[model samples]
Target chain A: MTLPIETPAVLVDLDIARRNVLAFQAYADRHGIRVRPHIKTHKLPQMAELQLDAGAIGITCQKVTEAEAMVDGGARIKDVLITYNLLGEQKLARLARLNERVTVSVVADNATVVDGLAAFFADAGKPLTVLVECNTGADRCGVGIPSEAARLARRIAEAPGLRFGGLMTYPPADGAARVQAFMSDAKRLIEAEGLEVPCITSGGTPGMMQAAEAPIASEHRPGTYIYNDRSLVARGVASWEDCALTVLATVVSVPSENRAIIDAGSKVLTSDLLGLTGYGHVLGRDDIRIDQLSEEHGRLVSDGQIGLQVGELVRIVPNHACVVTNMVDAVHVIEGGAPKGTWPVVARGRVL
Target chain B: MTLPIETPAVLVDLDIARRNVLAFQAYADRHGIRVRPHIKTHKLPQMAELQLDAGAIGITCQKVTEAEAMVDGGARIKDVLITYNLLGEQKLARLARLNERVTVSVVADNATVVDGLAAFFADAGKPLTVLVECNTGADRCGVGIPSEAARLARRIAEAPGLRFGGLMTYPPADGAARVQAFMSDAKRLIEAEGLEVPCITSGGTPGMMQAAEAPIASEHRPGTYIYNDRSLVARGVASWEDCALTVLATVVSVPSENRAIIDAGSKVLTSDLLGLTGYGHVLGRDDIRIDQLSEEHGRLVSDGQIGLQVGELVRIVPNHACVVTNMVDAVHVIEGGAPKGTWPVVARGRVL
Candidate 1:
C-alpha cells in the first residue's frame, strides 16, 4: 500500500543515491584508488550492491553487528573492512567468525588490542588482517605518529595468526594533506623495516572528495556521500538535491501565524544538530527555522511569517543521515513523489 | 550468554524504574486524577505493566505505531491515549483500525483533523474519543489560549462520529502554575458552554512532580519520568541513581592525556545536547566532559587531565532518555554492577 507523506517517515531518493555512488566511484577510479564505500550511512544491501556495480572494491562497516547484517542481507562484497578498533574477548570472537565469512580486516592502535586479536584468531584457527591506525590529528582514535603506527604494524606482523595489512587513518576535518603526508611517512617507515605495506586506507566523507588527489592512500571509505545530509551541503561537498534521504513530515499544528509544529522530532530526525541551529532543514523554505524539537514535535518558526495550515506535508533533509537511519525501522524509496518500495533499516540499532 | 559492561549499551536499573512508576502513580492517586504514564520513555511492556500495576489508569503513546506495539505486546489496558495529533488519510485509517482491537483516543486541534477522524470512525461505525490539545505556552502541538481550546473542544464534541473527551496540553518548562491556570480557565469555558469534559491531560516530567498539589489537570501523561535522564536530573526531579537508563560505553582510544574517544557517539548517546553543553553526563567523572561527538566516536576531554585507558568501560546518562532509547536495539538491565537479562526496545523507532 502507498503510505501518505506522514510527519515522520524517512524518504530516500534512489536516483540521487545511485548518482552519488557512481560519482564517488569515478573519482576513485581516476586516482587509481579503490573505493570502499562505508555502509554505515545507508546500511542497505541494495545500496551496497549499487556501489559495487559502480566499481567499488569493497565496503566499510563501523560495527560487527552492522557487518553481519550487511553480509546476511546479501551484500556480495568479498572484502569488508571494519574501520573501528575491535577490543574485548566477545568482540574478537565475533570478528574471527566474521573473517570466516569474508575477507575481514580491522584497525588497531595499541599492543593490547593487537594481542587480544592475535589470541582470538590463534585459538579460532583463522588468519585476521590488521591495520595500524594512525591518528591524523582527529584526536579520536589511532596512534599518535607514523613511528607509533609502524611499531604497531610490526607488532601485528610478528604476532601469531595476525597479518599486517598496512595503515588506516580517519583524518581531521578537511585534512586530506595531513592524511597524505602521514600515510606516505608511515608507508616508508614500515617498508624500511622490510615489511609488506599492502594497503593504506584513509576515509571520512568530508575528505572523500579530495581523497583521490591524495596519492599516498590506496583506498577511500566514505559513508556519508551515499546519503548526503545538511552538514555535507554546508561543507560544500553535496547539494540538497544530492541528498538521497529526507524525513517526510506533516504540519500537525499551525497554532500561530509564524509557528508550526511538525510530527517529526528528535525521535525521527535524531538529535545530530551537526552545528545546525535547527533540527532539520525544511525543503524549499529557507525562511523557516526549526526552533526546537521535543520528543515527538518539531517546532518551526518562520521569520518571514509564512502560514502553514494543519495537515500540510513538508520534507526535511536531516543534518546527519547516518544517525537518522538508525532512528527508523523502514525507509521509503520515493520516485516522483510516489512510493517505490520500503527498505528495512536492518542495522538500525547495532551499536555494539 | 553474558553481555559485558561495554561502553554504549543502554543500562536500565529496574528498581529505579519501578520506583518512578509508583511515585508518579501515587501523585495522581492522591490528587484524585488518572495517571497515564507515557510508555515512549521505557518502550518496554514490562515497565508499562509496572506502571499499570502501580495504579496507573492506562498509558499514553506518542504515535499509533507505539500504541499498536504496546497493545500487541500484552498491555491489556483498555484505554490507550495517543497524545499527538493525527494527520493524513493513512494515519486516520490506521487509527480507525486500531479501535477494532483496543480502545484508542487521539488528540486534535484543527477542524480538518477532527473531520478526518470523524470520517474514519463513521466508516467504522464507532465513536472516536478526542482531546482538544491546547497551547499552554509550549508552542508545540495545541490550540492557542482558552478561547481557541474551547472552540476546538466544542467543534470536536459537535462533530459527527467523534466524542470530545476533554483537553490536553504539553506545558512549557515553567511548571504547574501556568498549566493550572490555563487548564482551569479552559475547563470553565468548555463546561459553561454545556459540554462535559472527562479527561484533562497535562504533560512534562518536572511539571508532573508538582501536579498533585495543583488542581488543574485531571490526568497526567509524563513520558520521561519512566527513564529519567540528565535533563530530569538537572531539573531536580530525579537524582543520578534515579536515572533508570544510561548508555554503557567503552573507551576505545586514549588519544591524549586529556582526551579519550568512546564507542558511543551521536549514534548511541545521541546529539541531544538539550540545554546542557555536553552530550551526556559521565557517570563517575563530573570533571570530564564529552566535548564533541562524531557519528561513531565520542571525544571526551577532562579538565582535571585524567586519562581514560583503552578498553575501560564508562556509563553516560544521555541528556534525553527517550531519544537514546530509540537509538538502541536492546537495553541491558543491571543491578549492583552485575548483568541482568536484556530487554528489547520493542516500540523503539516506531515513528509512524
Candidate 2:
C-alpha cells in the first residue's frame, strides 16, 4: 500500500542505511577497533538495533534523554556512553536514575563535574564510569593537553562514587596523528600514576576510517557514517549514492525563468552549511543551486535550461544529516523506491 | 513558584514580549494601518492571542498547520492570512475546510497555485480570498512586476472559487518606495478591470515602521517584532534589551584559557548567522564571541580576560529567533525572573 505523504517529509533508504551499517561495522572489525555508533545521527530505535545487530559494541549519545529514548524504544541496550558533561542537580538526578537501569558512563573535563557526579553515587552499588574528555585538536570540548586530561582523570579516580572509565575525544577531521599523540601521552601520564586506562575513544566520521592508525584508540564513535550528508560528500567521506537520507520536497513556485521555490526551507533542510556552499545537493539537477532559504521557502536558482515546473517533487540531500534528523519527528523508510515503514526520530529536541 | 529548569531551554521574558507587542501595535495604530502579527515567530497560540489583544486586526501564518494550531490553541482566531502558495490535494482540502470556519485567505504567485486553489473551493459557501503575491524587491517569491500581479489577480477574479484580494509582498528591507510604486501600479491595473482593491499588505520586521510610508499598503505583517533577535539589533531596528527570547545554557567544558564550550549548539541556538558576526550576543559579556557551533557544542572564544567557569549559566540572544523557535518543543515563560508557565512551540517543524 502506498502512503499519501505530505510535502517536506524525511525519507530514509533502508537498504542503503543497513548497507552503511554493515560496511562500517565490517571496516572497523577488519581494522581491529570496536564500533560504538553515535545515536545523534538517526535517533531511531530501529536504526540503533540495526547497528547493534551489525556488531557495534554499544551506542554513544550526547544527552541522557537520547539514551533514555533508545532504552525505551526496546533496543536492549547494554551500554551507553554519553560524551557530554552531565551538569545541574536536576540532570545529575536524571543521570543517576538512568544509571540505575543500565551500565551508563559519562565524560567530564573539569573537577566541578566530577565532584557533582561523585556527590550522587558516592555509595552506590555500581559506581558511575567516567572518562576524561580530551580536546586533541577539535578545540570545542575536552582538556587542551595530555597533562590536563591526566589531572582530570586522577581527580575522577579519587572521587568516591566514580570510576575512571578511560579517555575520549572528537578529534579534528584528518588529524589522526594529533589523536594518537594526545591519547598516548594522556595514557602514559595516567599509567605513570599507577591508574589503568581501560579504553581510549576517538571519533569523527571524516577521519573515522583512519582511527585505527592511532593505536591508542581502542574504539571509535562516528555518527554521520550511517547517513552521510553533503558535508561528508564534500570531505570525501561519502559519495552522493552513499547518502541514505533525503528531504522530499515539492516545487511550489516558479516565479521567474531562473528561480523556483520549494516547500522545504530552513525549518526542514536547516541552514547549517557546515563550510559548504549552498544549502543542499539536488539529485540529477547539477545545474540548480539552492542558494537561499527563507523560513518556509527554499529559493532554487538555475540557469534557465532546466524546466522544473511547479508541483514537481524533488529530493534534496541536506548539508548536515544530524540537524535534519532533529528537524522531523518521523521519517519514511523506503526500500528499493518502495514504502516500508515510518520510524520516529525518537530523541529529537532532547538538548537537555 | 520557582520551577527548576534545564539548561539550553528557550526562555521568553513575558514582560518584554508583551511590551514589544504593544509597541508594534501602537505603530500600526498611529499610522492607521492594519496590524497582522506573523505567528511563525513564536508559534504559540498565547502569543497570537496577545497580538490580537494588543489591537492586531488578525494573524499571518506561513502554513495551514500553523493556522490550525493557533485555532486549536484557543486564540479565538477569526481570520488567518496564509502568506504561502496553498498546494496539494490534502492541503487544499484542509485550507478549504479552514476557510469554512473562519475568513481564510492565501497568496498565489502563479497560475498553478491559483488553479489548484480554485479546484478545491469552487462550490463553497464563500470563495477563498486570493491575493497576488508581488515581488517588490525580495525576489524569493511572487510575481515579477505589477503586470504579472495584475494578470494573476485577473485570473483569480475570473475563477469561480476564488476572490481577488488585493496585493501582498514581503518587501525588501528599507524599500518602502519600491512597495509604493509596485503596489500602486498593480492596484491601478486591477481597478481598471472594474474589480475592488480592498487591501495591499507589506511585510518584514526590519522596515515595518516604514511600511506605513508606502501609501498603497493598507496592512503590515511583522513576526519578529514580538521577540527581537541579534539580527534586528544589528540592523538598528531593535536594542539588545528589546530581545525577549534567549537560550539559557550552562558552560559544559572550559577546555582552555581562551575557549569555553556551552551546552547550546546548533540544536538549540541554531547556525543562522543572518549576516551577523557571531552566533549570538552573550548577555553582560561584550568581550566574548561565540565563534563556532557544532551539533551539541557552542565554541565560545575569548581573550583570556573573561573567566567563564564550568557549570556557569549564561543567557544568549540568538542571531535569529524564528529559526530557534522551530528548534525547541516548548519554551519557559518568565515574569520578573520567575517561571510563570511553559508553552509548547505548537507549530514547530510544521514545514508542510
Give the CA lDDT, 0 to 100, for residue A292 in model 2: 97
Model 2 preserves the real interface contacts to a fraction of 0.84
- Candidate 2 regions exceeding 4 Å error are A1-3, B1-3
Score candidate 1 by TM-score against the native. 0.96
Q: What is the TM-score of chain B alone in each candidate?
A: 0.95, 0.98
Please provide, for model 2 over A114-186, each residue's C-alpha lDDT reduced to its tens digit, 9 standing for 90 to 100: 9999998897767999999988877788888899889999999999899999999988887789989888899
Q: State what share of the real interface contacts each candidate retains.
A: 0.73, 0.84
The TM-score measured for candidate 2 stands at: 0.98
Q: What is the lDDT for A78 in model 2?
A: 75
Q: By lDDT, who's the top model here?
A: 2
For candidate 1, the lDDT comes to 0.83
Model 1 regions more than 4 Å off: A1-7, A335-338, B1-7, B335-338
